[model samples]
Target: MAKMRDRRVAPSSERRKNPFAAATATRADKTGDSASDRKLVTSFVLLCIVVIPAVSVLLYYVKNAPRASHTISLAHQRGLIKTDVTYQEILTVISENASQLHRHYTYPVLAYITPWNSKGYEMAKRFNTKFTHLSPVWYDLKSQGTSLVLEGRHNADMGWISELRMTGESLVLPRVVLEAFPRELLRNKKLRDKAIDLILTECKEMEYDGIVLESWSRWAAYGILHDPDMRKMALEFIKQLGYALHSVTSVRNNKQHLQLVYVIGPPYSEKLQVHDFGPQDLQSVGDAVDGFSLMTYDFSGPNNPGPNAPLQWIRLTLQLLLGSPSSRVQSVGWKIFVGINFYGNDFILSEGEGEGRAITGREYLNLLEKHRPEFQWEKNSGEHFFLYSDDNHAKHAVFYPSLMSVSMRLEEARSWGTGISIWEIGQGLDYFFDLL
Candidate 1:
């Protein structure tokens, strides 16, 4: 401490010229730059891996979520939700209860709409949401010499097509009873193939969802039912048509296979002499087609004085279809749709067989509203009737099904996990829509 050490200071020119010192300072600067570059690259990687996906998820949810006001308004319009509450309150309620009622119902509700019926378009618009399939009873086939041809022209109006499509429903081509029975066509393979080809071509051109084959042939006739040859021909024709139809993809729905529905009369009882369909035929046809629409109604018309479709008869008919353990019903219960009549049969008190008339559901409801007659609901039969004197001064008994009857039928269908279809639309009262 007492001795003073020699203080040596390097010249400024020497310090600037020292390459080692310069190299050391440059290494420190490069090390700091490398650390900053690593930090920037890490941040960029995290943004791509985490932040991008988070933003995408947020955008997807926003786009797909239903708007509260629109959903609430639609519910109110459908009479599903009451309008007594305030808009804000309804929004909250709808948000909370949306999952309970929003598209909750399963099973298809197919409605037959005839072009001749003036109310067809209006009814389609009014009840489009309720119907899963809208079938126009428009087309048929007829024998043209040795070949079969489309009989009636399809509806030219394309307006209904777009309107129905907008509702997320399908328009199926309905082939009613051709002038000549289909069995006759089936007898000739050449004619059957030609007919099926034409039908498939038309379906592809018109972009139909599928075809419906209605029961009109006497194949189910007592004489023909005993003929094994005729039954074999009929089954073969169905199988071929089904195969051809399914092979072609639908233009309307590319992902879905074409549907083939067979509409047949109710299964006959063992003792019933006037049976149209046998159990064997039912099983064979059921296996070939995508679904079976059982025409359980029309038990009585103007010709007979009875309920359109008595509950007891319906139950028996269902039993006949579903009774056999080896039958198609057990395996394909969901494919079977029980047909409901939206019309009624009116018989005059003095009329004999075939003396009464068939009236639409709207006509019957109108009578009830205008006359205000003593309405009677037969609980046991699940039918509604009223006694009134017509303009002819003759007593008349009108039998029809009310909403109550329809509800009972729906419950029956649900128990079996089966579907329900209406014979025709644009015939029912407003309240009937509420039940659906």
Candidate 2:
């Protein structure tokens, strides 16, 4: 994020007069007043008369709208309006209140748009230019016989992409997860070439600006990273994919080189083992890729039931990836896009409630209205929490993002001179756009 200049609003001078309250000069004599002058003065006066009153009326209604619940009833009774709009308005108001925390950052914001979260499509269009890259969770690489194929192409919204581009020039990079990685696919040259060709062909056909490739987590889960040969092959495959994407310039996108963003998993533990991608991996593939989308959230889960992502833990993860001054990875910080989670977790502290689930902005608002629990801030984690109970009397804990927590996280990412990445915009509140 860039450092913003400090601005101070100058106080109005005592001599300054209100344009509306100022007295109008009397009309000149017919002989003295030219036709053009008369016409100009009349137009100016008319404009003032119309605009001033309209603005005043708007301000008055706005100032009293929050306290005037009876207006809705009165309008409904007179058959002039419906409560649905009023309910929506109330929900918006509630959302705004929950979005009290606001901070401004000028970093490369890469946001993900999921098909499941319908709201995210509109959110992407609404905040079009705020993001540098929009990775719609659309495509996944799956095996069809011995050859690889790109699935989920049917889910792509071409109209929405065009609409989003009309607003801003954010690169439309659909996320492609490696779902069918054969055991020896990375080591096999022909199979690897086939996968790259498939990705390139799909991207070219769709006229996409680029793609966000996610495979590290899958590789780790499959224990591929545990094998030195396989890990090296995996990095080589990424480098080759990056080479293929970067070598071509899209004719549809004003002759811009196709971007390749590699998604990397965060350091699960402080020990910094080889099972996960570390600084060495970053250095190896740094030049091949445009940027690294670091999955930094999910510090705690249902098993532990703590903060979604603690501030201190995030710092440690970054430290591991970026390294210390003596062993710092050259130019790694600028290329890193730190992940930020807009949603929170609702953990079940006791039995009968079932497994914990992720909480959305709307769900968080509903809980606030239902429980009205007092919020407590965890200084160490830099998050806000509240406790509630269901009819069964089973306790639950919610660790949602608060104004201070979001502000601190943004600033922390800014301090590292790295970009910000939202897991998915749909799960976040509308007001969160204020920060971007």
Candidate 3:
């Protein structure tokens, strides 16, 4: 009895010492105010959750708010317009753009390729899809008949020098490659021979869809445009070029026809108009070659904000081409590729600086279709008519289209039996392959 009492006394003493020895009997309610504490803990956790994310998003929006809503690449940024294009990849893009075009026009467009700054051949080799490329092998405007490549300063942003068509002096080039050609090579007879050798070698190895002589207007026009001797020499060179292309195509036993294309112009002294070029100018160029590629852009005065070679002017020119006795030659020869803008028509300025839209080719569609839904192209006014504010901005883009607009460009192409060439290769015209 004494031992049992001692054991019980020991257990009780241990319990008292531990202060929490009633473990089996004790519960959460005994230890604390359970309901109120739980409520307080839940409220604290919920407040933490609500405040943290709201603060994060608020900070993010604040940081991005200062950025201009519509700024693309900044002005100082290089507008090189390059892609890390593989040969196969670029061909794919060509096929893609071609296919999208097919949906709009049942007749697949005669996809005419334009030469890139220095990347022509590399671009040509990528595709087996046969199209047109305007080769630089023909008489270069810079060196005239003396050299294949142009050698002069790149054209000013205004493109004013070509407007002037310097009489006795050298004209400036609008590309770095031509501007940087070796002077010694051009001056020395032996070097000139070697230069021709190098150029022909590359051009022969990789054939273009066609060849375009630089400023054919300057070269083809006798006396009125340039010295008769220079004009005669240039024409002789063009004849040789035409014959040579005929031989190469003949040798391949590929009856692939060549289009000898050229960019023509009226001098800077004269006002630029479609009527500026008459039947005689077209006739002279047609006699030299297969087609006329009107660089139908840059017709506007220097720094004009109007559309680059507006459709009004374009329609006038096209109508002339379509109507002329040169129309026979014009039908096949009329390769009218209206130059689309990679840059703006001119700057929208802020205090004499370009503080305007860096409108891209795709963005033009927005003006015609999205921004001003009701705008139409007026023929008599010879421009896209729209309402504008006194602030000198094009407020509503109302475009004019009779038969000459994009609405009928390809349709008319089919009707008139001519080619419609755009000044580019890549865009999002891939539905043809994808629909498969």
Candidate 1 local lDDT, 272-340, one digit each (tens): 332344455556666557877777775543333445665655655665566533445466656777888
Per-model lDDT: 0.56, 0.67, 0.32
Q: Of the candidates numbered 2 and 3, which has the greater lDDT value?
A: 2
Q: Which ten residues in a row have the lowest lDDT in candidate 3?
A: 1-10
Per-model C-alpha RMSD? 34.7, 22.5, 31.2
lDDT of 2 by residue, 190-282 (tens): 889888898888888888988999887777767777888888888999999999998888756656888899988676544566767788889
Top lDDT prediction, candidate number = 2
Lowest-lDDT window of 10 residues in candidate 1? 20-29
> What lDDT is obtained when candidate 3 is compared to the true structure?
0.32
Summarize candidate 3's per-residue lDDT along 172-231 as a digit string, tens digits: 111112221333333355544543344344334433334444434322221222344444
Error of 3 at 382 (Å): 7.5
Which scores greater on TM-score, model 2 or model 3?
2
User: Residue pairs in steric clash, candidate 2?
Assistant: none
Superposed on all Cα atoms, model 1 deviates from the true structure by an RMSD in Å of: 34.7
